[model samples]
Target: MRQVLLINKDPDMHSDLNSLFQENNYESVILDEVETGNEALRKVVNDSYDMLILNLDLPNTNMLGLINKLRLLNQDLPILIYSLELEYIFIKRYLTSGVNGYCFFKNGDVGEILDAAVRISTGKWYISQEMVELIVEKALYSKKIDRFDNLDEQEFEILTHLIKGDTVANIAKIMGVHLPTVSVYKTRILDKLRITSLLELKNIIKIPLLSES
Candidate 1:
C-alpha cells in the first residue's frame, strides 16, 4: 500500500479520503492542526511518504512560502495541491512551481482527487482540463508582464489578505510574523502590483490578467 502526507483539517473530508484510499489500496496520514507553518515544514523534513497532498485554504496558511520552502527542503517530494481555489490564474503559479497535481472536491467529486494522488505518486503531472485552457490563454497573449506576478509568495499572501479586508496587524498574527514585517510586505506588494490602494487590489483580482489586452 502507498501512503500520503495529507495536510487537512476537515474530519469529514479525511474520513471520506480514508475510505476512498482504502478501497484503492492506499492510506494517508492526516496532518494535525499546525499552529505555526514551521511545524508543517518540520513534519515534511522528518517524515517519509510517497506523496504530499496539501490543502491550500487552511486557515493562517502561507501557501506560497510553503511551496518555496518545500522546493528548497525536499525538491523530489511529489506535491499535490488539493485546493478549493477556483481561480485558475492564482493556481497557475503552483503548476509551474513543481507541484505534481491539482484538483478540487467541488460537488464532492472524489474520483478526481484519487486520480490526482495516483498519478502524482507514479511521477506524473495532473491539471484538470479546464484549468489547462486558462493557463495557456494567459501565457499566449503575454504583453507587459502582470505586476501581480512579480510579487513573491509572501507578498501575494499579504496582498490577498489585505484585499479580503484583513488589517496589517491581523495579517501579522495570521502569518506569525511581527506587525512591521507584514507592513513591509504590504508596501512591497502594492508597489509591485502598481496599485496604491486596497480598492484597486480588490478590483484587480476580480478582473482578467493585467495588461493582457
Candidate 2:
C-alpha cells in the first residue's frame, strides 16, 4: 500500500481525505493539528512517508521554511500543497519552491485530488486542468496586479482569512481585534479590490478555477 501523510488543521477535512484514501487502498496518517507551527515541523522531520499533503495556510509556523526544511532533509519526498486559497501567484510561487503537486480545497473536484495523489506517488507532477487555466489567465492579466496588490499587510491577512471562510467575528477573534475592526478591514478590503460585496470577494478568491467554469 502507498503511504501518505496529511498535515491539516481541520479534522473534518482530514477525515474526509482519510476515508477516501482508505477506500483507494492507500495507507495514510492524518495529522489533525488545531494550531501547528514550528513544533509541527519537528514531527515532519521525524516521520517517514511517501507523500505529504500540507495546508499552506497554517497559522502556527513559517510555512515556507517548513517546505524548505523538508526539501533539504529529503529531496525525494513528494510534497503536495493543499490549501483553500487558490491565488495564482501563490500557486506559482509554490511551484518555484519545489512542491511535487498542488491542489486547492475550493477549486478541484475531489476526484482530481485523488488522482493527484496517485500521480505523485508514481513520480509525476500533476496540476489540475482547471488550475492551469487560472494560472494562464492570471499571467495574461499580469498588468492588473493591483487588483490584489493594493492591500496592506493587515488587509492581506484579513483577506486570506476571509478566503479560508472565516466569518467577521471569527476573523476578529483570530486577529484579536474588535468586531468593528474586522468589519472595517473587510470593507476596506472589498473597496480596495473594487468589489462591492462579500460574495463577489469570495467569488474572486474562494471559488476554485474548476467551479468558476
Candidate 3:
C-alpha cells in the first residue's frame, strides 16, 4: 500500500481528502496527518512515507524553507502541493523547489487530486492542462525578450534576495558589501529588468502567470 503524509491545517479539508483517498481504491493510505510544517518535518524525519501532500499556507513555517528542507531529507520522495494558491509563479516555484505535482484546490476536484497522487507516486509530474498551456505560452514570450538574461550573476543574486524580502542592509551584509554597493546593484537590477520599484518587479514576475484572457 502507498503511504501518504498529508500536511494541512483545515480539519474539514483534511477529513475530505482522507475520505477521498480511502474511497479511491488506489491502495493508498494516509499514514500521517500534520497541521504545521514543523510537525510535517518531524514525521518525515522519523517515518517512511511514499508521498507527501503539502498545503503551502502552513502557519508555523516558511513554505519554501520547509520544501527545501524536505527535499534535502528525501530527494526521492514525491511531493504534491495541494494548495489554494493558484498563482502560476508559485506553481512554477514549487515545481522548481522539487515538488512533483501541483493541484490547485480552486481549479481541481477529487479526480484531479487522485490523479496527481497516482502520477506523482509513479515519478511523473502532474499539472493541469491549463497550467501546461500557460507555461508554454510564457516560455514562448520569454524567448522573445528574456529580461533575466540581461542580469549579471551578482545582480541576479541581489534580485533574488530582494524578492525574498531581504532589506538593502541585510543584503549588503550577506553579500559582504557596503550598503550603498548593494543599493547600486538593486538599482542596476531594476533598470535591467525594466522595472521601477520592487513592487513593479514583483508584478512583472507574476505577469507571465496571469491568465491570458
Candidate 4:
C-alpha cells in the first residue's frame, strides 16, 4: 500500500483528503502543521512515504526553499503542491522548481489529488496540460511571438486559454469564435496530444518543465 503524507494547515482540507484516501485504500498520514522548515525536513528525512502533499504557502518557511530542501533530501519522492494562490507566475516558478506535481486549491478537486498521488506512487509524475497551454500562451502574448511551434497560431491561442481555466463560453468571447469552434479546437488539441483529460494535461506540462521554464 502507498503511504501518503499530507502537510497542510487547513482542517477541512485535511478531512476531505483523509476521507478520499481512506476510500481508495491508501494510508494517509496527516501533519496539521510544520512549525518550521526544519521540522518538515526532519519528517521527510525520517519517514518513508510514497507521496507528500504540501501547501506551498506554509507559514514562516520560504515555500520554494523548503521544496528545494526536500528535493535535496529525497530527490525522487513525490511532492504534490496544492495552494490557494492562483497566480500564473507563481505556479510557473514552482513548476520549474523540480517538485513532483502541483494543483491549485481553488481549481483542484479530490479526484485530482488522488490521481496525482496514484501516479506519483508508480514512480510517474503529473502536470496539468492547461498549465502548459497557459505558460506557452502567456509567452506568446508577452513576447508577441509563437511559443508553441508544435501548434498553429489559432490552435495555440485556444489551447492556451483553455489551460488558463477558461470555460468554452469565455474562450469563445476572447477568441471571437463561436462556442462550437472553441470546442472543436479543444478536440483537435487533445487528439494531437493524445490526451483525454485536463489531469493528463497537468502531468504533461509539469514533468518536461521541471528544470527550466
Best by TM-score: 1
Determine the C-alpha RMSD for candidate 4 after optimal superposition of all C-alphas: 14.5
Off by over 4 Å in 1: 27-36, 142-144
Best by lDDT: 3
TM-score of 3: 0.71
Give the 10-residue window scoring lowest on summed lDDT in candidate 1: 27-36
Model 4: residues with Cα > 4 Å off, grouped in runs: 27-36, 139-213
What's the ranking of the predictions by lDDT, best on top?
3, 1, 2, 4
lDDT tens digits, residues 65-110, model 3?
6788899999898898876655565566667768888887774375
Task: For each candidate in the order shown, give its overall lDDT on alpha carbons.
Answer: 0.72, 0.68, 0.74, 0.66
Scored against the true structure, residue 46 in model 1 reaches a CA lDDT of 88
Q: Per-residue alpha-carbon lDDT of model 1 for 96-210, expressed as tens digits?
A: 7778888855777778888887887778898876677776776796565666677777777786677668777888887789998998887787776767877777766754547
What is the overall TM-score of model 1 with all chains considered together? Answer: 0.83
Model 4 lDDT per residue over 21-120, tens place? 7787665444334445677788888877667888765543345556778899998878888766555645665676777777766554767777876776
Ranking by TM-score: 1, 3, 2, 4
Worst 10 residues of 4 by lDDT: 204-213
Q: Weakest 10 consecutive residues, lDDT, candidate 3?
A: 204-213
lDDT by residue for model 2 (123-180), tens: 8898866578877776685454435656665676677677667778877766667999
